[model samples]
Target: MLTMKNVTKVFRTEMVETHALRELTLEVKSGEFVAVTGPSGSGKTTFLNIAGLLDDFTGGEYRLDGVEVRQLGDRARSKLRNEKIGFVFQSFNLIPDLNLFDNVDVPLRYRGFTRGERRQRIERALERVGLASRIRHFPAELSGGQQQRVAIARAIAGDPKLLLADEPTGNLDSQMAREVMQLLEELNAGGTVVVIVTHDPEIAARAQRNVHIVDGVASHLDRGPALVSPALRTA
Candidate 1:
């Protein structure tokens, strides 16, 4: 679970002060899939970074998986992040030269897993994303959807408690987006807490909850699934 209370993030320069998040309060429970929708510069990215422990908040409190994260040192935070959080970015963030297996193996390497264990985890992650056979292909050799699936594989290889995705389907076509969404749905069903920041309302409808952010504040929209598909219902 994740919780943020009255969280404020300020980016101050010599010339001006920019408030990326103002009194932002949100909570994501275990096994929940939440979609974050916001306009440009509405602080969705900042919230994601803070929630993923990629950045620190200037004020308020945040707890992740029962640990208070307000003032942890960089080393401690990085350790916790690597242990508890996974991230998928819009850009895919894959190394073009590294094959699929190697790309997914990168994070496991940092965890100090042996070659055998790393291979095991890599295989499982890719299989979950339906990309096991493409493990030897480079990023450039794959379609956008395949590359994103590899990115998701890389994120889930650690078995993270929380998965944070930013614009996961931004680059894919409708069918590919649905495929990626289905993969995420399956992951959530298996109990990995998922948070996605996206601009597409239709995609947002697939999640359990939709949160709209504006002017650095977030409000949860009390509505049912955008469509009553069986997958969305169970997810």
Candidate 2:
């Protein structure tokens, strides 16, 4: 679960000041799939960065899974982020030279997992993303969709409590995007909380809940029962 209260982020320069987020209060519960949609400059990325601990807010409180993120030191924040959160990015962020297996192995290596343990995690994660047989393939050799799946695999290898994706399907074709969305849905159904930042209405519509960001705050949120429409789940 995630909670934010009066979150504010400001960017300052010698001559100009910009407020990226202003008292943006948002919450995502366990097992929830949330889509954060907004126009450019609406602070969607700022919110995602703050939520994922990549950046600190200028003011307000943010708690992730009951831990106060705003108060933690950098080292502690890094540890918490690695342990509790997974990330998927728009650009796939894969190491160009590493094979699929090694790419997924990178994060687990930081955790001090032995070769056997890392191997197992990588295998399972790849299988979950439907990329088991392509473990030896390089990113350049795979299709865009396969590359994105590999990114998802890398994120899930740690068995994170929360998954944060930014423009996850932005580079893929419609069919590939749909497939990726379906995979995300499946992951959410299995109890991993997911929050995505997207501009596509169709992509946002697939999430169990939608939050529209405007002027550095959550402009709209549907507080209806946590109900996922049936159609969003199908391939």
Candidate 3:
């Protein structure tokens, strides 16, 4: 679960100041699938960075998984982020020379897992993403969708409590996008907390909840069909 109360982020320059997030208050419960949608220059990216602990905010409070993040030291924040959060970026962010197995292993190594533990985690993560067979393939050898799946596998290898995806399907075709979305949905169904930031309306609509950001604030929040559907449990 994540909570942001009156969170504000300001970027200062020599002559101008930019507000990336303006007193944004948002909460995501455990095992929920949420989508954040907005146009370019909106605070979507800023919010994601803050939520992922990749960037610092200028004001207000952020409690991730019940720990107050605002006052945590950089070392503490980094450890928490590495242990609890997973990120999937639009760019894939894979190393060119590394095979899929190595790509997923990199983060596990950083987490200081033993070699055997890393191997097991990597294998399971790849299997979860349906990429176990392609673990030896390089990023360049896979299709855009497959590459994205590998990226997702890398993120989930550590069993992160929260998944943050930014423009996950930005470079893929419609079919590929749908495939990726279905994968994410399946993950959420299995109890992963997934939060996606996208500009695509169709993608946003499929999530259990949708939040619209505009001008550094959350402009609209919708519970979407999942909240009212009898078949879906309230997360």
* Alpha-carbon TM-score of each model against the true structure: 0.94, 0.94, 0.93
Output the lDDT of residue 207, model 1.
81
Please list the C-alpha lDDT of all candidates, in the order they appear: 0.90, 0.90, 0.89
lDDT of 1 by residue, 101-125 (tens): 9999988888889999999999999
lDDT of 3 by residue, 1-235 (tens): 9999999999999999999999999999999999999999999999999999999999999999999998899889989999999899998898989999999998898899999999999999999889999989899999998899999999999989999999999988877777778778888888989999998776777787898999998965675553342312221
Supply candidate 1's per-residue lDDT for 198: 86
How many backbone clashes are present in model 2? 0
Task: Report the Cα lDDT for candidate 2.
Answer: 0.90
lDDT score at residue 121, model 2, on the 0-100 scale: 99
Model 2: runs farther than 4 Å from truth? Answer: 223-234
lDDT of 2 by residue, 1-235 (tens): 9999999999999999999999988889999999999998899999999999999899999999999998899888988888889999999999999999999998788777899999999999999999999999999999999999999999999999999999999999877888889889889999999999998777787787899998887876663433433443355
The ten-residue window of minimal lDDT in model 1 covers 226-235
Residue-level error in angstroms, candidate 1, position 137: 1.5
